[model samples]
Target: MFGGRALATLTRYRGGLGAAALAVAVVLLGLIEPTEYFALDQFFELRGARSPVAPIVIVSVDESSFVELNTQWPFPRAMHARLIDLIAAGRPRAIGIDLILDLPSARGERDDAALGEAVARAGNVVLAAAPADEQAGYTSLPFSYSRTTPNLPIDAVRKGAAGVGAINTPLDSDGRLRRMPRRQWTGVEWLPGFDVELHRVVTAAGLPAAPLPAVDPILINFSGPLRTFPWVSYFQVMNGTVEPTFFADKIVLVGPTSDQMHDVFATPFTRGRDQMPGVEIHANALQTYITGQPIREAPVWVSTVVAVAAALLAAALVVRLHPLRALAAVSLLWVIVTLFAYLVFVSGHAWMRGMAGTLGLVLGYGVTVVDHFVREQRERRRLAQFFSPEVLNEVVRHRREQSLSSSRRMVTVLFADIRGFTALSEKLAPEEVAEMLREYLTETTDVIFKHGGTVDKYIGDCVMALYNAPLQDPDHVLHAMQTALELQERTLKVSARWEQRLGTAIRSGIGINTGEAVVGTMGSRQRLEYTAIGDTINLGSRLEALTKEYGVAIVISEFTRRRLNADFLTRELGEVTVRGRTQPVKIYGVLPADLRKHPRAVIDVSATLTLSGAGESHPVATRDVSEGGMALAGVPEAWAVGTRVEVRCEGGQLPGPLAADAIVAWRRGDEAGITFVALDPESGPIVADYLSRRRSR
Candidate 1:
């Protein structure tokens, strides 16, 4: 019961305009770095990052070496031998020359010839062979002062040892290098980076390409720099003045290293302002191959789908839930993901888009939540805490719980209208009309509630209602009748006053029927309303509509008239055909007769009071009565067919119910029959007994 009402309340609130606006808000927000969703793509392009599954070294031509060797632009070939000797001294695997010899130098052919003679003597020397800008153009294998040099062609070098493809790296859109390139375009097929290429070179030399224990300068950590790496003068090396171990068996990259004059690259290890030579960049690349710390990028389609789905999820939540709840739920989602990601990021070396995802979630939720909540707040700007709250607070309580369902319990419904409101409104000013209708509705609606009825909705001058909801009223039928009669009486009093004030009477007719009705919120996703539909409800409306025909103020169906135990004067108006109803329904009309005047006399076998005679408060008790399956002794003889009643004891505060007419359908002896009646369902047995005892006293 509790769950159903809560659900119904939430459904009602959901059908309002706020939900639609919230849905739009959610769609427009929901991602942080939707653009950089494919991070792995960027990770794959870094050349230096992908190199070095094996050890590598670089022989750089530094500025100092340039000045000292006058080898300024083109250092001679002998200089490479000296440095190669020093590296070879380490007994390393292989050597690679990142230095491009595509262009001839100013040193002349003499220098190149001598360099070739020396290179022929050397067993392990590698030089760079790169593609020319023009396919038809070819200068030399290794430029050394001429169009050609002492270096062998790439094909020859591949024969002499394992020559590797050393291709240039391209930058990403942002100009920030963050990824590693695995392979580059070869003349025919894609080929590996410098590091992988070096692995082939080393293993070809009968040495394994497996990772080795080498003294790394930056692997574990980096704080500051040493005076410098082993950098000998280029000319000094050419002149054979440097150590021979440098070229012994090391994997060396011979590349330019001048601060203002060499092909250099950015690296994670670059200090202050000094750039690492391209040779060292290759070295880093090789080391990266050894570690294999690859960052995976999501597929483009996956990112697009994820982003779009995230938006849809937000929309779903918005339309399905209240703005406040959806906001909290979204916040919880981010927190959970962030916590999960934090754990993963710390434990796993996986760097899968942290900041971007965060930005997406934060921005998405922030903008969406703010938009949703703010709009809701604006719509509820006149938000009041139970302003003129109804008597049956079940709706309010259900609203608090935020459920979305409807129950199939029975409820009594009532429909009421002013007997002549249409003509009255037509005669008055709009403002005056509004004021009059508002005043009457306010009072009449309150009366329905006072009897524990839910005012379903007000249609012009008519009010449709239900009973036994929110807080279940056991005597819903009884209350409906009471509410109807009460409203009729209040209207008479009010009408008389209005007549004196405005020289016109405002008569209202109330119609109430007690039966099961389907009451709930019903509508579209864009809009909805709280009301009911059923034949019983139709009958109730029909009864109210019949008031004009009957020339009586209050009308009710047999279903309702049979449940009251009060002294209300009602006449069975017989059958009446109502619109949309196939058969005529039995109905009744309530006359504004004073219960205190006749005191509901049950004419005994003793005396009879004239219809116009004075009366008293005492209910003439019948010794016996019978109605349907019910019979009672010492039952109030005043009991009429629809009289409201209570079970009473001598001096026990009437323990059961208020005075009912006992609904004497038939009378026999001292035993009179009384139909079971509930005057007020919300009103406990105490109020019933109190009324019965007081009336008897």
Candidate 2:
């Protein structure tokens, strides 16, 4: 039992659970490193260009330099020595050589000596080194640290340079250089990157060191596409065409930019054939540190939390809203997430993947919509058992607008039962009884559904139905009465067939009442039933029982009688206090034309009536007239259900002026039923003659 209850509760909140599940899935997918990297690259492309904080210049060994010097693949070390001496004379903060110089110069020992002497004269140069692939090392940190054998510059040149650091440009899976290590861990020592070593050289020259990123692989904040930094050709610098003063007070980065040299790699800002040179990439990295603004990645936990939260929120909202409105809401959320991510990337230099969250919103919406469709289809199947196809369509189409939650509504309750069914069932075989009941119930249900009534439930031989509930009906009372009358007519045919089979007839008693009642699906979560409960429904059931006492096929309360037009003939059965009720209820038996004893003459006459009890008078008209009683139309009140009233009729083919004193019998709407207590002797003959004339006509 407990498990059943728990299952029901979970079903009730399945939308939320589905959303949470989607969130978890999205978060897990977002944690993938490749996805994060891809998002980071997109953010870089969208952010476009930004100005670098450090004043840095690139000295490029371009195709023009190669042509101008007519030098082979490896330029003579004396040539580099001349360029270094000129840049050092300008008093630059630091000079970084991006080329690997781990081998002796092919131009001879003296050529290597010349480059070593020039690096000693400079006193503030950082040479690039590499990590040997065969020697791998390990560390215990959150991010991976590069561990390998050290590849250092030739000792003759390395001994003279201020620092020697690894030049490692790690590419994402897509083969794009976007990040670099702050430092590499060799077995014996930690070697900083080329840019980090340059920063050290600058600080060693008495400049304050900028703060470095704490993460091992620092995300390089590219300034822009290729050659964003100021560039001068090495050939121009060597031949005195470019002044050495241009390098003063700046960090100089010198590396090959010629396509022939093949020192270029793809980057976020560079696409297809437009790749950034290796030296320019190092310049951007150095500027990233010098500006103290490396792109910081948001914590994994934080991104996961945001994506999940967004998905769950989407689920909660879409589950309750219309499909079109939910789609619009999801689209708006996507825009907001994208804009927020972009702002953080551009302004704060922080990478927070928004694609996962936005994708979560989309998926959440889709799943909830699918779930809603399935639930609605299930509900449609359930409702089909209670409502006609037309009514069921209306209910399902406007379900969101008219929810089936329990609420108070003015409705007409109907109860019908086969008279003496218990005794009749005992006398028949079980199979016979089942067949008999099935045919009887099916016919009666068809009658109820014909008038748009909701079949609430069946209790043994009795069926309870409701009108003006789950859907609105302005003429619910009339519909219920019509259904009851038709059911009696159809039962006669059923009784004939059953009487032939069992030598006993079957008759059904129907009762209808209209008033305010609580109506909707009600019961425990495990088993819910759409039904109604209140005094009105109880009174309807009581009246159905009273039909046997009155020997009538159908009975209705005063509440229902008042709503009918003069077309329906009814006989008042006086007031009786039903079981469980202190107040007496007035009921009437609906009679067909053949059963009415005293037929009322249909007449439309203007008249005036005075209520002696209330001491009030009002203009009235006659709906019909009989010798015993008359229905007074336009009488606002019932005059306390027995108060004596004087009615006067004048003119309008009434023979002559007639007056009578009558006792109020019943009242409904603007009409009142009254029986004549006495008629003035002079007017008695006149009313009789007038009614006779109307009947003859």
Candidate 3:
């Protein structure tokens, strides 16, 4: 049993658990390097461009040089020899030629000899080399690479160059070049990168050298996109269009930059057709080495912990707040995380990859919103049982705190009971009796709901309802009265049908009162009921019981009668002491205009009626009379239905002439039906006494 209870409790809070799980899952997925690299690229993009620390120049073999020299493809090796001779004359600290010279020139040995001689004279040139094949191995250290063999320059050029460095630029899984291997293993020995070799040469010439990190492959702090460094055409340097002093003490890199060469690759700043050439990538890498401030990535464990903490925090906040407020709070947190990561990247030269945390926050918030919506729908379904649709919607929309809490407030309470139901049930089978009760209760509940009343509860043959408790209704008293009248009208029709089928007739009585009452959910903690308790409620119940004593279908307290907005016909039933109250409560019987079959005293009285438009008086004799209406004979045919007339009755135990305004209800031949529209104050007691004496006989 304890296990079952535990399972139920877990089911109730599953939404919160689900949100936390998804957040952690997303953080784990972000640990993959490729997934986090995208955020690093955005940091670079947001930082824009900066000046490189080292003085570097690019000898670009670009379109402009091709057009100016009138040359096509692979300008003869003698031209490169002339360009190197011009740069060497400047006494530069270092010169890196970013072209592979693994094979002899097609222009013959003399062509290759000329380039080799230029390198011999310069004594500071670094030639590019590559691996023999695509095969490479990973070392135990993070991001380290090794190659088994190298494809070096030809013997002639190799003998002259100061160093032959690997021109291998490694790309991440997404094909973006952001880091370079500091050195590669060639099985026999270690080979330095082209930029590393240039840095060594520059330091050897007595320039200060920045210490490199112990890590094998290092992130390059790229200053910008293509052409960020100073550039001069290769052909211009050969023809002396550029001065040699420009290369003095500067690191010069010579390589292809034309679109036809196809030596460019995507970088952090690459967008649309703009890409960085391989030579410029080497320049950026060399600058990073010279400055010794390469971009360092946060350890995997540190980033993972931060991501998880951020996710959990977001989940806690969203579950406690309203959905709209939660959305705003989550959005603010996302911005802070992104800005913090960017600041660390720019100022501290570190990359944190904060996208994981932001993504987790969004997912947590989204799932929590869905959970709230589902729970609200369930609560709505539960409340729908006791309130009408309109009242239920209002309750859900506003959700006032005092709606279900105990409080004292002015309200109109109604009690309705089915008369003679116990005696009728005794004569029928249990199934038949249940069916009868269901039909009767269904009709009564509908009428109460139609007038915007809350059904408090059902006690066997009785239904209790309240107005202006859970939701406010300024005209609650009037609404209760209307509900009672309509309820009785419908019950009479139902009773007639049941009488024909079961051989017994039934009726219902309603009592309504308006006063201060304590209304709300009240009972044990395990089971509670929404009801009213006060002397006002008790008095309302007493009035319903008095209906049988006074032979009336509906009764209302003086408090309720005083609050009615519209005129209604009622008869005072004198004051009586109720069961629970010391004071005698005044009650009135409600008379509906269409109540035609009420108890009547058979009597004949002479009466004269004046028609409103006929301008004459007519003589009529009363056949029978009730407080609501009277049956008449010997009426003129001109008195049609809905004709207004004045009625004055004399004699027949009426101590004086009783005057009242009435309207013709129905007519057949010379007999007309008259219903009292208004009665003089003095005429009320006279009519009551005459009917009382006639009933006594």
Candidate 4:
């Protein structure tokens, strides 16, 4: 029961639950390292390649250069010095040597002196440095090392370069290079990257402050796969084959391009065997700084907010749309989020988290759609349990669009209680009592249902039913009366069987009232009940308790009595003050089922008669009267059998004048009979008084 109720509550407040689930998912994503790189990589691929910048260019030591120089793997520093001198003549903005010159040249001091002289003449050069040891932890903290691996430069070459920066390119968990940290900690101080140091050399006056390592890494928006920048062969520069103007005022990077050099790394734009050289990667970074657009990534808080907002949008759509439409809407929302991420990255150089946002959208909307279906099914089940099948059908058919909120509706309520069941239980076994009560309650409920009433609930041996709720009925009071009458008969029949079986008697008293009352399915999201409550329902229960005092099987309040037609015969039981009430309520005892006509009557005299067709009035002597009809002696022949007339009885044997609108029933010579079409409430006391006196005499 608890589980079902909780499920129902979740189903009702699905929007909140969905939002909470989405928030949890976002937190988990943020806390856990990314296991999948497909979403972010796809975004990179979607943005595709961009045009290379003009200021940054690469001077490649390609296979051609190796063959022309006729030098082994690490070419002697003489060739590099000669090539650098040839390029320095153009007065380039800056020069970045992608190779590390930590060791002396094999050709001895002459080669070292030659390279140092060329570098010193260049005046603007940045040397490459790498961490001495591998970083191994979540934060990738570096080891204690005072100098860069391969050291920055030998004393001969170190004096020429403007500054030295690390060349450590960290790969993500997916083994793909997407971002590069701008600075690193070396236990003693923070070291900037080769590209950042080059940027300082190239644009000394316009440089932004160096960013810390913990700051969000720069998204490497690669311009192309490989060799995107203008490349000149080292041999070509040394041989004076390339024009000097090619390197003038340009930030030139000299690096190996031959496949055997092993200086290539995979980038976002990498495809198949086409990877970017480490020199070009640095060049791309330098260009990004020079252009003042680094392709920033969304901060942790922004990603979190985007995820939750996506979830909320999806949830709101699911709540308002059909399941199919919701599916379509969520799919569309995912697309929109994906497109938005791409657009932001393209226009603002900021990348949003696409994977978390899309996941939140799909899951949030899907869960709520399922919840709505479950809630509707539970609502139908609850309605079916309280109402008769006929009433249930009416509710399903007519009230499908109605909201199940509590509201005031004029409904007729009936309360029935077994009179002797409490005492009889003491004389019978527990099993016998249970069986007897079940049978009695079942019969009572069936009778109520047959008269088109809703069974609100069974309180021990008492059964409460309602009319004109869950479904409206024009003749609700009549239906309640009929149910009570039938229930009385049903109880008597059951009591006779019980007397034969257990030597015990069972009787029931029922009360009915008709008036305005609050009625609807009411409860929390977890549980619901269709019932009625108000003065009408309270009076009905009160009258049912009064049945034992009045010694009657069925008692109905005057509110119900006044709404009834002339088909019923009742005894005015006077007024009694009930509990929780300020005024005395007039009540009536429903006469037993007689099947005979005019079962209620009064002995009276002095009645005024008016014929339907004739205008003449005559005084008549009254013999007996019933709510249905009255008999009179010395009636004129003008009062025909089929004629309708108005009758008024003066206060001769009654407290007040009695007036009835009636039709003629039969005529025996000068006497005519009339049947009552309706009776005014003022005459009820007069009829009761006359009947009370007749019984006395």
Candidate 5:
């Protein structure tokens, strides 16, 4: 059933069920980019912004320095020559000028010559270049532009600088500079990026490139947030206001650092006002490439595997655990996964998809919670069909525990079947027959429940039930007898109604036996059921079958009769060999109504009695007595039949002491016949006491 229900749920919610599919779609379609960026920021925050790499420094031409220069926006190349000389004086390993001087200075050839002389003297300098698309050709003029080529320094500066490299930092769609294009094809040849070329010129031997495809560029592992690099203002360096040894053997990058210059960009390490300037991004890139630890992203297939595994694990946890606990567990799992990804990225220089995996896990947890709630409701409704409310509650309470192992238990099993069900069905239309059977079974089941019995199951036209099992009933046999009497009385009215409609009456038979039997959830695993089985149950069934032969509506075994508490009226039905037993079993027919013509036999005995009448008591003697009634002599001859009298046996010569309320049944002259009134369960055990005394004697 659970399997079928699962299949149904899948079919009902097909195509897209829960958050699992949504999460997968999100990852596949790149819909997780924004959220993932946020998560990546959090990871960076957790890792703590790193310290800037040493051996690299920025000489920024900040607003203060720009004003201090006291020149136009594009300062005279003569001034640039002075700054280049100042930086070159430090004997740095390399000097990279991030500003582009693609054209000769309009100031005159003297200014250009001044800058070129400085660049030529500084043999370790590299000039930045930019892509310029035009008619392509090689040129000695650095300022000359060409299609599919880079605009480089003026001829004077180009002839002076050691090498040229592209200063292009590519931004992702979000406008965040996370990666750099490693190389670009100029009309002449492929050239390395600014940082790569800087590393090449500094070390004089380029590092081995990664095993990445040509189209896929290198990811930047930013060393820290903005302004992390060691720095000195252009004015400070030129004015000689700082230590001269600071730039010794270090790589220096010079660029604008003023918002007025508009050289800032967003990066992963950006926080508050900490936007990175281009020069520092190049510094970080140089450090990353030189150290040979560029951040490497795993392939898409690897991310898919991680996402699926996390999702399945999360779903299982949600199904097995309570909701709040599952949420806490999932949160912990995400934290661990994110931390692992951070460790891998930081220590191993490999980027992993932590955010995508986390999305899958959270979605799985949510879907499983919803599915569990739906499944539980379905299970409750299905179980309602098989178990009563009380039983169902107990079963649910102990569902996690195994409580239904097969074991021998003492119980009373009852079987009630419609007599001549086949014959009755033949005479009526199919629908009418169904209606009649349904009504009879419903009433019979109600009677069984009224007596606190469990309807184990219905066998076609027969209703099998149990007592003192699944729940306990101390007076189970007496309860069974009461249930049978009520069914007989109730069905008689139903039979009468049916006889009027169909010209035939309905009749039912019930048999009850009490003993030990195996009672529990039985049958194979696939078809298991809660019921009972053993000789006692078989005997109950056989007894019901024998009811038709005995011309009785209800027959109970002697085992059941012996346990009654004297309130029920029953007549002995002579023993007969049942199908499976060697010995005959004594049976009794339970009477639903009084039988005034019950057989009476002659008996002569003197019995003492105390009588209550008119709110007074008197003692009398009995002429003769039978189980049906006692004939008392010398009573008021005027006492009429149906007179209510209460009697107590103070001391008697009969089989037992008796105390009961009785009614006058018959009388003749000085003799009156009185029968004992039927007692309730709580009343004193009259018949049981008599039987006990008889057994002792």
Candidate 6:
């Protein structure tokens, strides 16, 4: 049960948190972060230097060119001359310009005259070819399509040199230039980009070449994710500063590299490099192609599954575990994966994943934790509603106490009954009886207020009331006695009206006793009840039943009567033997409080004839009494003392059976008889006390 409850609680907790967490994870993983993650992936593809193998190197017009020339966008044609002279002096292979000479500019006539003459003179030069992009009247054809503006200058470049290389680098969604364009179209011809053009140039110049390895294209023998190669400034190369022989028989590709150009791309070689140019990317691409081993290209579905599954798995695991454990586990997994991913990039020439996996685990754990706590609080509230009003109060008290590491004490109990209730019920209609009973009990119950009594319950016409509380009452007996007397007076008023209406009279009797009993909640966890209970409670019940034997309307046990401190008119009802008690107890009746002041103390007894009339002497032990009945163990089976009989005593002749049995109460289940002879001495005082107490109330 414990394991099941714990598991269920954990499940519910995670279930709720998972829902909200799922939403956040979806937003971040699917919508917001993918673009960035994919972008990183793209940049890595290009800079990874592991694909589209081809031998090539950059001849860049980077920050150095701009800074030395004191100009930004437009470079004088004479600059092209100096670059060409340097390459031509080396007697090198192909030289592909990575920039555009698209239209004539301010110094165009002078610069173009010098550069064009020099370009025509140099046998190894490939002037840069600029296609009219969509922004400049070139239609957005697929990269393979040859659509362009009328002034693309492709024919002019084709006529001026060994070849016009298309220098466009194709990028993936991640903005990384991974794959080199296989081909680019001009108005009249198909062409290779700088990487391919340079490849042809190098080979024609008698360089070594080999078949490239490929996943898509081929991998290049070049630095991986973090490796770096050397670089020198363009202006320095042109000022007769570089050893031109290094350029000999070497293929060079060149273009701009400045942050202002906004040509910067995400690549593995340099982190979103500001001054790297398009020609450098092309050079990287060629190296990748020539090396022949491309990074393994995984299918798209693999990525999606890995991302979502990682999220779900981590979430499920943490749903039942403690939060700290879940978090530590997630963190450890993240670190392990990150290390492995870096190794793939460094050693395997592959980029796996970065932040996506980490985010998935964290989101899973967080969502489940939030859900668990909310469910716990709600369950406690739901349980509180399932108990009865009385029991609920006590259970709640105990529960609150338990939370604070405490508990409640046991309570005392008392029970009372009306004498001759069966005969009373026999004379009335059910409806009339019910109405009268309700009114009578209501009045009696109200007296419990002065007595500090809590009415425990009602059984037929009987009342079970308790003192010493809902809390302890210091003078509980006084309260019980006072309350009982008030009830008697109130019953008289209620009975008078009903008697007139029903043409019948009513009388009630009460018995009360008190003792400590177990008092607290007891029941199922789902539903608990609070009540006092013990042998003390059972004793109170047994005492109420014995009231009829003594022929007294109110009888209290020795335990109860002893708590009283005040003196009052009273009568000693003969010893009454009750069921469940092996011994008999002396019971007492509270005399009416004002018995001395008025006609009071009413004692009413009724006896049914159980056995009588035969001519036999009753047992001797049965004949000894103070003019009162003794419940005899040795009575004749059928005895009739003919209205009176004498007892044979040891010392002298004793009282007759009729006289000795004067106070024998009504026979109610093996009961002794009350004879008329014993009533003379006590009748006046009892009646006076009953009336007096009734009046006081």
- For this target, which candidate reaches the highest TM-score against the unseen true structure? 2
Model 5 lDDT at residue 417 = 86
Predicted candidate 1, C-alpha RMSD: 31.0
What residue runs in model 4 are displaced by over 4 Å at the alpha carbon?
1-10, 13-40, 134-150, 205-216, 387-697
TM-scores of the candidates are 0.40, 0.52, 0.49, 0.50, 0.50, 0.41
How far residue 117's Cα lies from its native spot in candidate 1, in Å, is 6.1
lDDT of 2 by residue, 252-273 (tens): 9989998878888998887779
User: Could you give me the TM-score of model 3 versus the true structure?
Assistant: 0.49
lDDT by residue (tens digit), candidate 5, 1-697: 4455446445333322455567777878877777766766666666766776547889988887867776657877888788888878878888899988888788889998998899999888988987656754456667655567567788988788888888877877667888888777766777778877787777772323333334347777777788778878888887888555777787889898777788888998886776888988898888877666777777766666666666767876775578799889999988888778888876887778677788778777777777777877898899999999999887655543323367788888899988889987888899988898899999999999999999999988899989988887887887887788778667766876886687666778888898899998787744779899989999999999977766566788998888887677677878978888999999887654333323333333444444444665555665543444555776665455435577555344434455566665445466666766534343345444443444421
Order of models, best lDDT first: 3, 2, 4, 5, 6, 1
TM-score (C-alpha, index-matched) for candidate 2:
0.52
Q: Judged by lDDT relative to the true structure, which candidate is superior, 5 or 6?
A: 5
RMSD in angstroms between candidate 6 and the native structure over all alpha carbons: 35.5
Residue pairs with clashing backbones, model 4: none
Ranking by TM-score: 2, 4, 5, 3, 6, 1
List, residue by residue over 1-697, the lDDT tens digit for candidate 6: 3455546544554553454356455544555345535534554554455433333445556677788867666677677777777777777677777667667645746666677666666766765665454443345655444346423333333356665666666565555555665456665666655566566666677777645443433323334443243345677677767767877766666566666666556554445433345556666666655554456543444444455555665665665467788778878887787777766756676645454555556665666566556765675577668866677667544433311111244334555544566877777788877887788778877877667888877878877777775676677777787776666556556755875687555555667676667665555655664455666677777766765544555677777776766554455666766676777877776543323123322122221232323334543333212222232334343332212322222222211112222222223233233333223443434333434444422
Poorest lDDT segment (10 consecutive residues) of candidate 4: 205-214
- Give stretches of model 2 more than 4 Å off: 1-39, 135-147, 206-209, 383-697
Predicted candidate 4 versus true structure: per-residue lDDT over 1-697, tens digit per residue: 3455545445555763666466656556654226225666666678777787647778998999878878777888887887788788887888889897878887898989988888888878888776575434444456543333345578888777788887778887666776777876655677788888887787673434343324445766667667777888888888888977888878889988877888788777777898788888887777676666776766666666665766666766776678789789888777777788788877877667666677567667766667667866887889888999898887545432323467898888999988867788888999999999999999998998999999999999999999998788998898998898778667767876887798676778888888899887777645788888788888888899987776667788888899988888687878999898999989997764432243455456678888755767788877777655677877887655435578998865677888986655445566655666567888866676666666631
Model 6: per-residue Cα lDDT at residue 10: 48
Assess candidate 3 and give its lDDT: 0.80
The Cα local distance difference test for each model comes to 0.53, 0.80, 0.80, 0.75, 0.74, 0.56
What residue runs in model 5 are displaced by over 4 Å at the alpha carbon? 1-18, 132-149, 185-189, 205-216, 379-697
lDDT of 1 by residue, 429-507 (tens): 8887787778789888889879888888889989988888756889888777778767755765665566566755676
- Runs with alpha carbons beyond 4 Å of true place in candidate 6: 1-82, 91-93, 104-127, 130-154, 160-163, 169-192, 200-229, 232-239, 257-274, 292-300, 372-697
